[model samples]
Target: MDEALWAFGRASGVVALVLFTASIVLGIITRSGRLLPGLPRFSVTLVHRNVSLVGSVFILLHVGSLLLDSYAKLNVTDIVVPFIGSYKPFWQGLGTVAVDLLIAIIVTSLLRQRLGVKVFRAVHWFSYAMWPIAMVHAIGNGTDGTSSWFLLLAAVCTLAVGTALIWRLSSRFVESARLRQESV
Candidate 1:
């Protein structure tokens, strides 16, 4: 039973990482108004939202399974509060912090209309922090973190998100430059 729980925890954690990477990349692409052939902007936006929801579900499963696993010995407090766990406290705490940030982002998005766009946008920016924290936690705390497969997966995810971010930033820079040229 303990082994099963451990395996489930590891699998769920990996799945959550993959899904989160996809969500981040999709979000950047959506912001840039980039779409695959035959897909509209709204479709990209919908996919980004849905991917985030699914990634959150996987993250919950990852936390739950690890908490239940006797080998991990994670208490509920460890899952919520940062830096107090018996196990690899620093890395685990980073994961906890990322989870907290995700919760804030999700709640703010849900209340976006009431809170207004500026508030939601400000909260959403935390995702940039959350993703790298989560990645570091995974690489630092994961048992298979040094394995070839996990390294490849991490590399691919990093490359995809990095490319999207570069594209998004460069496009924005070009737009600002164009505006400045016209103004001048």
Candidate 2:
């Protein structure tokens, strides 16, 4: 049962990371106002939202399973508060902080209309912080953090997201340049 729980937690964590990476890339694409082939602009947003929701579910599973597993030694407080865990407190705390940021992002998104776009957008920017924090948590705390396969997977995820981020920023820069030329 312990082995089963451990495996479930690890698998769920990996799945959550992949889903989060996809959502991040999709989010950049959505913000850039780019249409995926055969898909409308809104569809990209919908896909991003769905991916994020699924990722959140996986994160829940990861945390719940680990909590159940005696090996992890994760208490409720450790999961909620940062840097208080008996095991690798710093790494575990990163996960806690990431989860906190995710909660804030989710709550603000749900209340977007009521809170206004400015509030929602402000909170959403936390995602940029959340992703790296989560990644670091996985690398520092995961059982397979030192394994070659896990490193490969992490590298791939980083590359994909990094490429997408560069594209997003470059596009913004180009647009600003174009706007300046027009104004002048």
Candidate 3:
């Protein structure tokens, strides 16, 4: 059961990172008017937003519980500080960075109206940095990281995230061109 829990936690981490990355990528290129062609007309962004939130919650819970499990031998500093874990410092630091980035992103999101668009967008760009940190954390620390099943799962996530990013960029390009055409 503990192994299963750990594995599940790792899975949630992968999913969360992927969704966050994909959503940011999508947001950047939404105006491109390419693949996810319906992105503008639908609730794609909303779904991405909500999903990332839920995934983050699950990941936090998982990491918190692991620290409490005794079997894991995690220190409080392990969670609060980056790269201070007994098992692996470099890989574990990635988790800490991700946590910090997530907090910043969420805090800024909550204050988006007050901060305004420019500041919010600048802070929000942290999502790109956070995702790869998370991916490295999961791939390096995950108990099942080397397993075929987990590898396949990670690969699929990478593909999905990549596709969404491409779609967003293209859509943004298309939208920009259309606007220019109309202006001319």
Candidate 4:
């Protein structure tokens, strides 16, 4: 029973990470208005939203399984509160913080219509922080942290997000520069 729960928790965590990475990449692509071979921007946006929702579900499963697994020894508070878990407090705390940030992002997104674009965007930016925190938490605390497969997965995720972030930021900078030149 314990082994099953442990395997489920690990698998769910990895899946969540992959989905989160895909969501971020898709979001960047959507923002850039880049259409894939057969996918339009709107389709990309839809996929991003769906992927994010699925990732969140996986995250919930990962946490729930870990909590239920006696081997992990995680309590409800450990899931909700940061830095207070009996096991691997620092790493677990990072995970908790990431989860809290994700929850905030999800809530703000759902309330985006009522909250207005400015507020929604401000909250959404927290996802940038949340992703790295999650990555670190997984690598530092995961049972398979040192495994070659896990490391490869983490590396791929990091590279994808990093490249997208650079592209997004550079494009914004170019746009701003062009605007400045036009104003001048």
Best by lDDT: 2
On residues 1-184, what C-alpha lDDT tens digit does candidate 3 reach at each position? 6666566666566666666666665665443434464455346556556766776787687687677655566777788789778777888888888888888998998899888767877898797687777877888987777789877877876777677566655634446566346334
lDDT of all predictions:
0.87, 0.89, 0.70, 0.89
Report backbone clashes per prediction: 0, 0, 10, 0
Q: If both were scored by lDDT, which would come out higher, candidate 2 or candidate 3? A: 2
Of candidate 3, the 10-residue stretch with the lowest lDDT total is 29-38
**TM-score, one value per model:** 0.91, 0.91, 0.77, 0.91
Candidate 1 clash pair list = none
lDDT of 4 by residue, 19-85 (tens): 9999888877765667767886569779989999999999999999999999999998998899999
lDDT for 22 in candidate 1 is 95
Candidate 4: segments with Cα more than 4 A from true spot = 172-184
lDDT at residue 16 of model 4 (Cα atoms): 96
How much is the lDDT of residue 89 in candidate 2?
99
- TM-score for model 1? 0.91
What's the residue-level lDDT of 109 in candidate 1?
A: 84
Give the TM-score (vs. native) of candidate 4.
0.91
Q: On residues 1-184, what C-alpha lDDT tens digit does candidate 2 reach at each position?
A: 9999999999999899999999999988776667799998779889999999999999999999999999999989998999999999999999999999999999998998898767887899899899999999999999988799999999999998999888877835233343345333
Model 3 misses residue 169 by how many Å? 5.2
Model 3 misplaced stretches (Cα beyond 4 Å): 1-8, 25-42, 166-184
